[model samples]
Target: MKHLLALIFCVYFSGCLMGQQQAEWGNWKNWGDQEDGTYLNPIIPSDYSDIDCIQVGEDYYAISSTFQFSPGMTLLHSKDLVNWEICSNIIDDLTQISESLNWTRMDRYGRGVWAGTLRHHNGRFYLFFGTPDEGYFMTSAAHPEGPWKPLTPLLAEAGWDDCTAMWDDNGKAYFVGTHFADGYKTYLFKMAEDGKSIDRKSAVLIHSGSGREASKLIKVNGWYYLIFSEHKPGVGRYVMAKRSRKLAGSYKEERQLALPSCEAMEPNQGGIIPGKDNNWYFLTHHGTGDWSGRIVSLLPVTWVDGWPIPGEVLPQNIGAMKWSGKMPFKYTEKLSIKRSDDFDDERLAPQWQWNYQPRKEYFSLTERPGWLRLKAYRPLEADKLLKAGNTLTQRTFRKQDNDVVIKIDISNMKDGQKNGLCHFSSQHSAIGIVKEESACYLEYRKNDNITRGIPIRSQYVWLRTQWGLDSKSHYYYSLDGDNFLSFGEPYQLVWGNYRGDRIGIYCFSDKREDGFVDVDYCHYK
Candidate 1:
């Protein structure tokens, strides 16, 4: 069983990817990767460029780009504006809109659905999103685990998109969306009561919308502040604002609070969630890895000189948020899900999901009394990354530079058979494996480049992905002992299509026949 568990992950890329390299004749485990514990700007992980977040009631929620990956809109929740975790993703499959929409397999490229918006009103949640290359859409569900209604195009046209919305105090609803290209030009309009469709004739272009475009309305003490931006990508776009006496009136420019950390990303329009207590915080992000590594940041909004400013640095409210700031809110040191999978339960954890809508027979270890069996799907091509059919994955939410371990016990893995683990976004994915030949291999693919085939001794293979704020990533392969072989370069753990990397396991086949792989445990440190 141990060998079976190990061998399943030993199969490397179909070809030898361990290109010519100097072999270090030392204890393989000697090449241990450790976290420097250094922190960088845009604290949390994500490249969800066109981002929009909302604080509903006491709980805060957010959504970003899914690009080609169906079951889109990775939803997030947070108590203190800083530390956030995945709550539920809204889509199960793109079956309703365009079933053939997956560019993650093309150049394994191009953006899918870019910027997204999350809005809550009258006890229901609303999500507005758009594929920059496709068109704009709006979908909703009572809860995040959406039976989400079919997708509907919000605007008559859809180029590059950024959509923002808010429910005004006088029982009125408004939507502000923008089109992107050389520069962003925005228009404000009223939405139908249902919040799914908008009044196109009511749309009005309010800004030059240069750089990036976005706007959200939040009023306080009778003053209505229109938050918008002219965020030019490189030169440090400002999170400027305009104030109007009324919700949809002519306003004036405010001020710039936070700038891009590294000179690449400037401040763009972040969603403003007005708390029940009347205070507001801005949910936004900045660039990290060469326009690729962008992450989410949060801040309290403070008004000085008649303009809004992000109260503290970035994510000044992560985990241990202050109630008033003078007296610290004392609680536990820190909190995060360490590990789970007592598959002893009847249903799968909320965090686990197949690539798209999955069926009962597709996978279920219960039949094997704790063995995970995933039917074979397809030979993964560059164009159908997640669409390769049966990819079961989860988001890597922890911020620590940790290692992930998965236990697999598969029987006959031969004749175009495949069973492996993966860290996937839209375009980037990787795995460590034991193929039918009994040889162990570590395989990884990002965009057009695939680096793989570093050998391991035993089939009991442990493949790990590690990174920190610096976001430099390394893959390590280990056998019986904790000793591991470090393969691949220090590839930055940047965003792929429109989201961050999600790790899980897969069983694919060209025949489209379902194959099964049983997994025991998965430990993330």
Candidate 2:
């Protein structure tokens, strides 16, 4: 009896400890939820750019662009707009769109999947996104968490972006998009009911201007509203909207909806979603590019004389940004974007993505239990880290400071193989092991510059990168799990390829595909 009682106590204690650890891990990053009936701005301080959101019966879903990354189009779910969690990724294999996105080529950089839309219609979830080189493509699912149908190309012509779809009351489907090939002309095209094709002859010019794009269409209270973004010559990007009683013509002259707040990046290019209590909110990203990418912010929408004004209404009818406000709903669930991974699960975390569509055979989670095994292979371009295959990555969230640490087992490393952790945009920096001629040496690489450190014989090492508000990154490594020693010169993280910095684990061979590394764990905070 005493033995059983002691066993019960031990199990209960272990469970509690695990629960505490998970709770702690979830709160490691700067989450917007204050847990006290109000939330903060930059709701998600990561690279979830070019966002579009919709609300469906008390639940909110938002989709963001994932350019040149495998598992494109990240889908997020939330009870309130401020707090969100990764629910699904719409595109699992980007190579379906084009082979140029494949791991071997590494061709597309800033140009793969651009702005798109997400809408729920008639018990189906539909997504439409575009590539500058490959035109527009879409996919649908019966449920948001889905076995999504394969992508179907809707338009084969290029130089189009920011595509959105709407089904009218009479069930006539319409598609709206911007044609950058012709100086930012926004057009409305009648789409077939099946959504597989568009009648090019039915195109109608809705709005046209210099630097006009990110168009969204919605019907509210017998009015058709078209919201979009335009770049001012000296002022940066701003949000604008026009409304009409008809979908095809006679939209009023566009009015300014929102602009940049004091010292903040321009607020532009997102969705306007209605709240549960007839209130409304605008989900937008800061348009000016920075090292943190385009971080998202939530603004309160106030309808003034039939115009849904986002944020605080100021002179000239533009809305001022709000940094914090009452929760859209009074729910208490604290959600966060998943970051750390233990490599114990059979599948990769939804937050993780390869730099491009990776070669499936080059990576495995089951090869070594409780570890992620990445088989080394030669990059398409020798000594080019960005051209390497199977580099697993996730967005770097902005905070006062952020740190990422990973434990790597290098016992299987071969000569000419490099295995380590990295943070990169166009320029990247990494600290890892370089196996050369029967000796293992610590190496720090910043772009094409390589700094070789002392020789080491350790079979396992812990690599870390620390970056802060300045967006400068410093790399360190440790033979033991603790006592890390800095190795590389500080690298300034940049905004490139339409993406912010990403932290990743990489393994690549400069010569042959005969080496591998096992990453036991990754902790980000």
Candidate 3:
């Protein structure tokens, strides 16, 4: 209540642009990075981890890891580092990586695309990402919002993750990647002139340290800086920097640049981007977090004696700082990922992502003029919703309560088909309606346990899931749009498979792939 009043006061007295306020993607009051000079810790208060940002002219393009989500490699663009909008997704189809993504087993939950590095070189946008089990891959496009050329597998061997690409002043390309096979070691590999293939014979040890990964190569003022992350005793995940005059050998010993932060510990594992004014900033993710997962934070970077310090360094080399400081660039506009979906448009919003590569024929927006029609298909197995394909999902929030409402039409549902909205994670819960032999019933699934057979005569009903910041979830249902009655026990939202909790709309069958559900709209507030 107080927060709402405070939000109202700030909206009124602070002269926040009404258009910008109306375009907020998530909770209004918790939006980070204010227009004032000083910005907050989390520039984005959601799970946008394994982030890498590159400055291309005055525009900034950033990419985040999307493990199994189809249209992977979430690309975000910003005029200022503080404000960003979803620009594009580099990988339009997960099947391009492996057909296993669409397998009946429905694999590749946390094993698909990992941390990626984005860079602009010679008027082309290049992205390099790795799979923990499938080695490294590269893709390129003339524009950041890309019809990115298909993923070219650079290295087919396993045990590599978090790779970055760069080209030296001599026109020779090099790739910096981490190999976990022989402990945590960062490797430097020479790349082909085109940057698609790496010379296997040119692999060299760049840096090796405990928990060291997220390797990136940055050149500044004739000195080459190799940035990485490490986990130390009692300090958590921290950033490390090593520098040398040359690109390959004779690098300096690692220096601790930043330490675990109180705002969200383990403020680690992100690349650095410089402002147009030449001011540098470190883009990091808080490794320690709740159901919001690893949220992103942008910290001020200062170069002291050739080392890039993330945030402010404390006395006695204790830890790095996490405080709101002066913005490196002017905050002129506000942007966010589009969230709400009325299903009235020809396209789905950027906030919508499939659990994996969705079968194109299983879902449609054009089939039903003004609704999202999800054709019900049998689960890969008996009754596992996680294995159910075409589950459209969006990230949930923390630090504030989130209300999700979805109106599902069951008029076309068939027996043995269950279609409704759910909160999904390692442990998931759903308040959905099921069509049985002769009638429809409301059902609830908590974890693996489920309760069904609550009769509902309506052909259309509204389902609601209230996700509290404290991780509690309340499920409700309504025949009419007005009043909502709590149906199930409070389910605790959880984190699993390297992802935060996601509120998703799913339609699957236990019998046959012969049913469908028309969703009028899904509203999140």
Candidate 4:
């Protein structure tokens, strides 16, 4: 009897331990901090593309292209290079820059706010970015998280992108960018000290190739390194470098710096910055698009004979891609980019952004105190998810399987209003409450196809989307918020408009605009 009791106790103890371990680590899909002094590749497994990072004091600040998403150019802050969080968004109203970015137009799908450079000099932070149609624009702030000055047009000509600026030792500013319309030709020009304008008359053609772009200029050890990406015939986009003793002209022949691996597609289009320990590191995004978009990775850097080589150095001075390495700094706290919102705060979390410049009158956090109230509005294009205005969204993580559950109150929903959760790229899938006449029904929409389920009489319903590594999503709806029934067909997530899949909460009406839904909370994992 004693032996049997001891066996049972041991079994119970082990089961509890296993359950605790699963609860701690099982749900997370994209945790990079190993917690053992090492970190993994794709430090951020979301769609933060066209990245540029800089070290300001002990804190590291990085920025990424937002494309058509409003709050253009996301800015991130990190204590250690492996752990990052959204600090702020540079452009709050993208319509201020171009009317094409307005929700009514929604035309700048893959073109607005492309690759940019972030630099801190003279006690201020400066950001320079360009659009394919709007040429180049810049903004500056006293701090990384800031009241940024209104964007000043640096150049108003089209066909230019991927702009970087550097202030030399003598305080002379220089700008480098690529002109895609002109055979991918790269040029260097003198920039004004204020960084508000560029001296186009000082333009000098530096490099030209079949598909050369993503220009970054930096000075290290008295050599000005011009780093960019060029398309290889069959190998995809790869990082290349050209060094010159002077800022202009006569650069050495380009050398291959980093190449794509089977796991990381095309390690290109990012900046190299010195770590806190004075060692250099390269933060880049995989150029090739996937369901997760261009995910970010941090590569170890080695200075070989005055050249900064990224990843493992191979023969002929090329860097082979790596998957894991020692942590740049010994940061023990596990940080995440995922958000769980309770809707109690006065402001939305930094991770949230509208599909475009939202019509602020239709969204309210104060309307219901502890809930997010989204009033329905007629979309510019009727019955189109992509054309809906005021849809709040955030990037979906793709490292492993993940899920999101949102509780919404549909009591206030009016006829012809659709209120629910959705995940979309170019195409979209949604599971939500669709009201018709005087009854509410649960509807699952995949692109244009609609599947209506039984009538829902509840005031509140919980909607969930579970997505796996296969890039497929399954949706569920629950009345009690405990037991959930599958609602939609297996929807495949996709990469489009140069963006990864984004999960959003939408409330819109195809008819009148008097309906509304209150989102109680959103739990994402």
Model 2: what TM-score?
Answer: 0.93
Residue-level lDDT of model 1, residues 86-161, one tens digit each, is 6766765655445445322322234555666777778888887766656677888888666777777777564756
Candidate 3 on 1-525: residue-level lDDT in tens?
Answer: 322332333334225433442243223354466666778766787788888888887888888888988788899988778878889888987777788776355787778889989988888999889988778888999987778999899999888888888887888888888887778788888898798899988888877757788887889989888888776553356677788888765675657665444334567788787876678888877776567778787887877777787876545332354546666677556777666789998778777888888888888999889999999887887678888888999887775767889998889989999887898877788989888897899899876578874799887899998876567889999999889999878988777888888889999998988889999999888
Instruction: Write one digit per residue (lDDT tens) for candidate 2, span 1-525.
Output: 322332343344335544653343213354477778777776888889999999887799999999899899999998878888999989998988889999978899998989999989888899988999899898999889898999999888989999988888888898998899988898889998878788888888887775888888888899888998877563456677888887765786567666534234666889999876568999988777778888898999988778878887765455766667888886666778989999998899998999999999999999888999999999998888999988999999888778899999999999899989988888888888899979999999889689999998988899999987767898888999889998979989889988888998999998888888999999997
Of models 1 and 2, which has the larger lDDT? 2
**Collision pairs in model 3:** none
How many residue pairs clash in all the candidates, one count each?
33, 0, 0, 0
lDDT of 4: 0.84
Model 1 scores worst on lDDT over the 10 consecutive residues at 24-33
- For candidate 4, the per-residue lDDT at 441 reads 97
Cα lDDT listed for each candidate: 0.55, 0.84, 0.79, 0.84
Q: Tens-digit lDDT track for model 4 on 1-525? A: 322332343344335543653243213354577788888777888899999998888788889999888888999989889899999999888987798888778778788889899999999999999999989999999987789999999889999989899988888898988999989998899999889889989998888875999888888988999988877554456677899887764686567665444334667888888887678899998888877888888998898877788887766465756668888887556556757889898888888988888888899999899999999999888888888888999998875768899999999988999989999988899999999999999999999689999999999999999987778899999999999999889899998999989999999999998889999999997
TM-score of 1: 0.74
Candidate 3: RMSD to truth: 8.0
Models sorted by lDDT, best on top: 4, 2, 3, 1
Candidate 1 deviant stretches above 4 angstroms = 1-51, 102-110, 144-148, 181-183, 252-269, 274-280, 288-292, 311-361, 365-371, 380-387, 395-400, 423-429, 434-461, 467-495, 500-504, 510-514
User: In model 2, what lDDT does residue 369 have?
Assistant: 82
